[model samples]
Target: MGMSAGYELSRRGLKTLLIDAFDPPHPNGSHHGEPRLIRHAYSGGPAYVKLALRADELWRELEEATGEKLLERAGVLNIADPDVYSYAGRFQDAADHGVRIEDLDADQIRFRWPDVRIPDHYRAMFEPNAGYLYSEKCVAAYKKLALHSGASLLPNTFVKRIQAERSFVSVFTNTEHFIANHVILSAGAWFKTLEPFVRLPIRSVRKVVGWFEPSVSSFEAGTFPGFTFASSLGSYYGFPDIAGAGVKIGRHETGEEWQPGEDLVPFGAYSEDEGDLRKALEAYMPDAAGKLLKSAVCKYEHTPDDHFIIDTHPEHSNVILAGGFSGHGFKFASVVGEILANQIELGHWGRDVGLFSAARFSPISP
Candidate 1:
């Protein structure tokens, strides 16, 4: 969010300073993991569809501007038992939003993707234009563009404290103190560290993702599509094998509470996560459960209601807080960046951002 916002703000002639605790394209944050799925059939709500559509446009724009391949149009399949989850409602929402989607029953899904094993009661929504974003590549491209647009980027800079005043905000780093007219707190898991100045209902949870070698060639990127299946077991999402990296799979809602600045689970150490994904694969796509190639742990800053909070600080309007993505926000990074920039410049985003305001979590007055 910070990188894309910096790029947008800098391009809009605002002197932007993009600061990160780690280097660009690092795996410490949520934007790691080679590819993140992007789809317009948002189960979160209809509000997300607009942002998603805008993000798709911006992603293509960035790719055209940088001449780098960022988004892969490999399609996405959302499969779920109609009785277990609201797949029907989600499909209707997608269609209502004018998104191109194909409704498929279990038989049709099995016929279309022979590798997948769908039960007779399952239904699917196939979004042909949805795909995955090369996450690291997207960040690198945004950073490069931000720099090219005259934005100063400070990597590996640890922010000790932030003092938000009526006039400006003071950010004290390990080396120096920088003051800006407005400050955006896009620090993913570390967002809570800004204490009394910016209090948010965001929890950082450690999530594990695994890459597995598929037994069959049908799971390759060209033939297979990214899938999110909601079942009685749990909600699981996976990507097709891209660049021979193997098919990546992970559970959506299972993660341990995590805190920033603490020791994290080492990469490739998530044996249990791999097992969970293996079970999902064995049930949904048995042929894809070949071998667990590798696993990595990342953090998801979740909101109380699993919705995003993209609003200004209640005490200090000049300080914008954009966190609590809840594990499903990477695809909306482009649009979120634009919204943050718009919030800073125009004082309003002209969209129905009320659903994401911090005021929703504010204490009620008697």
Candidate 2:
């Protein structure tokens, strides 16, 4: 995600410096998972839908610049009961934002998707433009472009401390220190340690993604699109069988509590979370959830609400804070990169960001 920001800054002729504790496109960070759902009509809010629309445009621009096929046009399936969030709230977002959406009943879904066997009472919202973004490749593409644009990138370098002042900010790594006129803190999970200097209400929590084999061979790229099932339990979303990795599935709900650099990253299947998830798959999508292949664990830096915090520091305008994406921030990384660059250079965003401000949660002045 930060790769795009660094690339955009470099492309805009800024002397950009990109630092990451982990290497770019490495499996250590949240960008590991191959595909993430990109839906225009958001269940989160109407403002997010607008942001997503702009993001879609930026993503296409990035693809053209990098000459890599980063985004897939497989569409998105949001399944839920008529009373659930996908049906009531997300449908409202589509209607309000004037995005194209198709409502599908159970019979319609079976006729269209063929493989998906939804319950009679359940329904689905189909956004034809929604699809998956190739995450690691996107990061790689941005990093490549950023390096070519003369940006200094330091990988496997830990940011030990940061000291912000009135005029400039001093950042200290494990081995080196960088003093810059402005600083943009886009650290994913290790964002809280710098909270003393730049306070933002963010928490890092553990999350996992599971891959399951389908009972039938209908889980191909064209046969099945990425889907999210809204249940009384929570939102469970999954992608199609891209690159024969079976189906990648994960819940939007919070996982176990975790502190950065302290929690154990799980790869093998376990009983605690997998048991319940498997039961859900068996009940809702038996053909697609029959075989549990493996699971990979990651961390999410979350706010009290699932919205992003993409504003500059209230106390110091020189320092920008952009952590707390929860987990849905990857899809918007293409445009967010530009937003971060704009915020750092202009000290204000040209886009509408009223819903993403940190001040919305409290009576703090920006």
Candidate 3:
């Protein structure tokens, strides 16, 4: 999010400084893990579908600007029970947005994707144009573009404190202090550290993602599509084997809360890290649950509403806070950055940003 905003802000002739606690494209944050799904017909809410569509366009533009393979058009499948909120939300939002979605029963899903073995009661919404983005590369591409556009970066630097004033914001780091007319506080998982600056009911959690060897060849990137499934058991999302990476899957909800400055206990810290993922795979795609090849532990920052908070700071208008993406924010990174840049310059964005405003929650009192 910071990198994308930096690129947009700098390219528009605004002196932008992007400070990261660690070098991005690093697995410490949520933007890594190879392929991240992007569904236009969103299940989160209708407000996100428009952002997703705009992000799709910007991602393509970023690819053209970077000349790198940033996104793929390999389609995505949303499977859930009829009464499940995800299934109904996705269907209604898709219809409202006019995004073409193919309604499929369990049989059709099995016929097209033979690995899936959903029960007869389950239904599916297939978004053929939706796809996944190369998470790390997208960051790298944006970083390069931001640098070329005259954006300065300070990696491996932690913000010790932030002093938001009426005229400008002072950002103090472990090494140095910098001041700017506007500051974009996109702390990602470490957002809790902001304390009094941000008190928006945001919590960071330890999320585990795994890649499993598939017994079926249909799990390959070209043959298979990314999938997000919701059932009585739980909500799950996965990606096809890209570049021999194996079928990547991760549970949507239920993760341990993560503190700001703590090293994750790795993927195997608990048995469920793999066991839970295996259970989902075995239940839905038994053919793709052969063996666990690898797994990763990342952070998930979420709002109470499970939606995103991308607006200016409540106390300090000069500072913008863009976070609480929950689990489904990466694909919106491109547009989030664009909107952040817009917020900094125009003090307002083109779209109805009420859903992402910080006013919904009171700022933490120091």
Q: List, in order, the clash count of every candidate structure.
A: 0, 0, 0
Candidate with the larger TM-score of 1 and 2: 1
Per-residue C-alpha lDDT of model 1 across residues 107-172, encoded as one tens digit per residue: 999899998898898988899999999999999999999999999999998888888789999999
Model 2 lowest lDDT segment of ten: 357-366
TM-score of each: 0.96, 0.94, 0.97
Candidates in descending TM-score order: 3, 1, 2
Candidate 2, number of clashes: 0
Query: Of 2 and 3, which scores higher on lDDT?
Result: 3
Return the clash pairs for model 1, or none: none
Q: By how many angstroms RMSD does model 1 differ from the true structure?
A: 1.9
Per-candidate local distance difference test: 0.87, 0.81, 0.87
Candidate 1 stretches with Cα past 4 Å from truth are 267-271, 363-366
Error of 3 at 341 (Å): 0.7
lDDT for each residue of candidate 2 in 1-366, tens digit (9 for 90 to 100): 588889888988999999888788887667887888899988677778888998999889889997999999899998887666546667777887778899988899988877776679888889988999998889999999999999999999888888878998999997888999888888887776675666667777777787888877778788788898887867888898876788878887857777767856574545656765676677777777766777778877788888888877777788777778888889989888888888777766778877788777653332
Q: Residue 358 of candidate 2: its Cα lDDT?
A: 70
- Those runs of model 2 whose alpha carbons end farther than 4 Å from true positions after fitting are 95-98, 268-270, 361-366
